[model samples]
Every structure is written in structure tokens, then in C-alpha cells.
Target: MSATTATARPTRNIESLTERAAALLGGTPDDETLRRYLNGLSGVDAVGLEARAADLGTRSIKTTSKVWALDKIVELIDLTTLEGADTPGKVRSLVAKALNPDASDQSCPRVAAVCVYGDMVPIAIEALGSAHGDPDDGGVSVAAVATAFPSGRASLAVKLADTADAVSNGADEIDMVIDRGAFLSGRYGVVFEQITQVKAACVRADGTSASLKVILETGELNTYDNIKRASWLAILAGGDFIKTSTGKVQPAATLPVTLLMLEVVRDWYRATGEKIGVKPAGGIRTSKDAIKHVVTVAETAGEEWLQPHLFRFGASSLLNDVLRQRQKISTGHYTGADYVTID
Candidate 1:
């Protein structure tokens, strides 16, 4: 696609990809169509991905795009470690990091929302201070991954309880994974039910609502069409953010997947006027990659998606790279590893 053509897509400039795909096949697309699309696709047959690419290219309004919503993005960036912090030292380290994210030599996002397993919320709460204590200087507002996470094998009641407990412990966001197996089985309704119920469980410690982000596990879903369909469902089901992967999956997040997601968000925005966020997590260990995602956001969703808001790279190891790059850009030399400290 020509750069000019790519950058020209507005609400009407682009075609409805899913609907187009359905029309291409001469049938309405349902969860089964999504499943079939994910099961196979080659460069020769990937018209959907091609269309999305073309549409993204033509998008203008760069700065006004939703990806630039850093205030929104920063709040949703969930600094997570699903392996669990098994010791007091680890919890203390997490606390210290939350309070002093700059210790990593990279200034943390303005509000480094902590994402711990349900077990660590109390420690995070005390360490950061009631996320509810003050609007400022408090610890991170916790986000807990629920719906059994990664494996996603659990009863509906159990998953709902997991979400409720996370919110009860002061978590501000619910990051839940869709049941990949069920989704793959062409059971989108089940996936929808899962996210809807869990989203309902999100509430603040003060008894308010916590935002919901639905993890698509894109690597496993394996196709742009499927990713788009899943993105639609999550947002329609109340996902505040549509994430790439769990950071547990191989090729966790990729430029291609992120690009597809940006298109999904843009289309979603045009349809509902409700802008949802996009997070590309897993396997992102460098600042350059983060910057590239930033650029993708800039180009795809426009400048509005540039900051942490509509765009975020989920990485335990990426902050340092951003810092290093910033420092390198700021100063003239490679100051070496000695310049930064990690707790």
C-alpha cells in the first residue's frame, strides 16, 4: 500500500474487515468463521491482513489519534510478574520498585499500576499506601490476572470469584485471559460469557468499579482476522483494553499483531465512539521495540495513541532499555550498565 493511501483512511475511508471477509466468503461470519480463519492463512490468502494494512496506512489525524492518550495508557500499564513474588524480600522489592520506579534508571510510567497475583495485593496496598489513600504518592493501583490465567482451566464460579477477590483486595484493573481452548473450539459465546462475568466482578476496595482488560493470547489464536474478532468481542463485552498475549506465550507480542490490534481499536472507536486501549506485551525486552510500537500507534491510531494510554509494551525488562536509549539520546556516549540500578 502506498504511504499516502495508507495514511488517508478515516471512518469511511476503510472497509469493515470482518464484514468484508464474510462477504468475500459469501456468508456471514460467526465464531466458526473466525475459528476457520485462525486455523489457516498464507500470504496468498491473507486478504484481511492486507486490507487492514492498507487501511492503517491511510489513517491521518496522527496526533489526535487515541494511541496518544498517555494519561489513559499509563493508568492501564500493569507492571506484572505472574510467577508470583514468593518471599517477603520479593514483596519488599516490588514495594520499593513501585515507590521508586526511577531506581531502575528509567522513570516509570507516571502511575506504574502494579499487577501482581491476587495474593500480593495487600502487600502492594501497604507498600504503595492505599491506592485509595491519596490521589498521589500512593502505591500502585493493582491489576490481577484472573479467569485462571495462562492455562485458563477453571470453573465459571471459580474464575468469577478470582476476579472479585482481586478487586476486593484493591485491584483497579482486571486482566483476564479468554479461554483459548474454548475460543479455538469455536465457542466464542463461552469466551464472551467468561469475560463478561469476570468484568462484573471488578470493584474497588471502596466498592467502585475496576476496569477490565481482556487478554487475547494472540500467539495461540494465530491470525489477524481472529484477533480482530476477539478484539471486538472483548470490547463489546466490556474490556477496557485488548491485550496481545500473556507474556507466557512464545512470540508474545509482535509488530504485526499490534498493528492488527491498532486497526481494531480504530475501527472500534469509529463504531462506538468508545476508545479502548491496546497493549502489546510479552517478549518485548527493548526500548527500540517499545518505540516501534509507539511509532505504530502514531501511524496506525494517529498521535493520540502515542503515549501509555492507547498503547503500551508489557515488559519487565523494557523500561531499562527505554532509559538507556533516552540516556544515549540525551547524552553523547554509551555510559555502560553502571548508569542504572535494578532492585
Candidate 2:
């Protein structure tokens, strides 16, 4: 299937976040335009998408460029640990690593955030205290995977409760997984409504709300067509970021998948005049892979999306490799794994 284009075009016209939200939810705002745009979306050509992503992956970088990319990618990282064995101690350790990814080099930039399960949010918050300050004050954010993360096969009440628990515990961001089963069944309305409801659940008691990243789990979606649909679905549903996978699935966070997401965010920005982020979790483990992703963001999405606010890599191991590469650039030789903390 080939990708379809409809009324999705960018314009200089911009609207306030409130206006966009009202428009999306109805009443004072209307989503008729958004509905038309989504309805007009066309199929995606899987072969062409894979080919283009492969071609873009071949683009190369040198020493100086790699150095710059390493630092930039560091800031785009969402250093994550979502295992079943995760403990408060483990979350604290990961938080420490995120704050100082490379203790050996003070020049190394801190990661964008530390992602953990909902129960671990308080631990991460405490560990990161005063280290970078609150997220509004330049401190690293604490992200929690909620809404029955990695599966999303739960009731709405349960999901919202899970989200409320995380936000109440001081999570700066909430990475919620959509109900892919509903999405796959062509129940677009169900998927969209759930996202809006989850977005609402992100609000804390202080009138502040956590940033919401809607995970599409592109692996389960199967084709680029579904990925495209899901991408627009999440965005229209008020997702702050459209993520690729949960890392538990095979074929998680591939280059083609991420490249497509970058394109979606770019298109969404053009059509809505609002910027959203793209995060590819799971298999991204090397500095080379990380830089290629940044290159894709620059070429496909634009340089502005290269920042942490608009782009993030969801991996725990990727940070250590980035730090190790930075070490090699500094000392002229690859350092042992022992040189960096085990994240």
C-alpha cells in the first residue's frame, strides 16, 4: 500500500493550546477539521518506506559532527528502566545516572528524563531532587509508564487510576499506551476518546499536569498504514508525543518506524501549528544509531525537533554507549564497560 495525503499541510497560522484542546474536545471547540484530515489519510507503502529509511540511514558523520551529535543525543535521551524487578533503589540509581551520565566528563550533558514504572516515580523524584531542579527550573523530569503500559489491556477506570497514581506521586511526564486492540479493530473513536481521557487524568492536584506521550506500539500495528493512522490518532487525541514501541515487543523501535513517526510529527506540526515530540524506544543502543536518528529528525522533521523537547530516545543501554563514545573521543581509545556505571 502507498501512503496517502489529504488536507494535512502546514501553515504559518497558529492557535493557542487552549484553543486546540477546546477544538478537539467539542463544545467551545470543534474537531470537524481534525476529523476530515484523519478521514482523508491514505495508505502507506511499506516497501518504499523501508527503502527510504534505509537510504537515510546510510548518511554518515565525522568526528566533530559525532561529538556534537553525542552531546545533543544525550539531552534527547529518556533513560529508562521498566523491568519487573525494578526497585526504588534501582530507580534512584538510574536517576543518578541520568543526572550525570558521564561522571568522568563534566562536559557531558544530562539526559532529558528518567522513565520508570508508576510506583517508582516518587523514588526517581527524590533521587533527582535539587540535582537539576524541578523540570520547570531545569531539573531532569521523572517519566512514568502508565495506562497499563507495555500492554494497555485494562479497563478505563483502572488505567486512569494508574495514571492518577503516577501524576500524584510527582511524575513530570506520563507515557501512556493506547488500547491497540481498539485501534486495530478500526474503533478510532474509542482510541481517540481514551487518549483524551488519559490526557485529563494526567492533571495533578496543583493544577499542573504531566506531559503525555501516547505509545502506538508500532510493532503490533503491523503496517505503515496503521502506523500513520495511529500517529494522527494519537496527535489528534492530544498526545504530547507519539512513541513507537514498548520495548517488550520484537522489531521494536526500528529506523523505518522512527523515520515515519518523525514525518508524522512534521506533518502534524504543519497542519496544526503545534509541535509534538517523537520517541523511539527499545533497540536503539549505539551512538551511531542515535546520531542517525538525529540526522533523520534534522532532514525529515527539521533541526528544531532535534532538541529534547521534541525528540527523545527511550532506552536504558543507549546512554552508557553514548557516554562510552564520548570517553573514546576524549581519550582516543575505547574505554572498558567498567568505566561507566551499569545502568
User: What residue runs in model 1 are displaced by over 4 Å at the alpha carbon?
Assistant: 1-77, 104-111, 130-139, 204-207, 307-309, 334-343
Could you tell me the TM-score of candidate 1?
0.73
Query: Candidate 2 residues 1-343, lDDT tens each?
Result: 0001100112111134436645654533224544555557876778988998888878766666777888888888899999999988888889888888887788887888889999887787778766533322345777889999889999999999999898887777889999989878777777877888888887656555677889999889888878997898788777888999899998899999998888888887788677988999999999878877888889999998886667889998998888877887689653433232211
Kindly give the number of clashing pairs for every candidate: 20, 3
Q: Single out the weakest 10-residue window by summed lDDT for candidate 2.
A: 1-10
**What are the Cα lDDT values of the candidates?**
0.61, 0.78
- State residue 224's C-alpha deviation in candidate 1, in Å: 1.8
Per residue, candidate 1 scores C-alpha lDDT tens digits across 257-292 of 888788778976786576778888898775445545
lDDT of 1 at 61: 26
Per-model TM values vs. the true structure: 0.73, 0.86
Model 2 accuracy (lDDT, Cα): 0.78
Error in Å for residue 187 of model 2: 1.0
User: C-alpha displacement of 98 in model 1, angstroms?
Assistant: 3.4
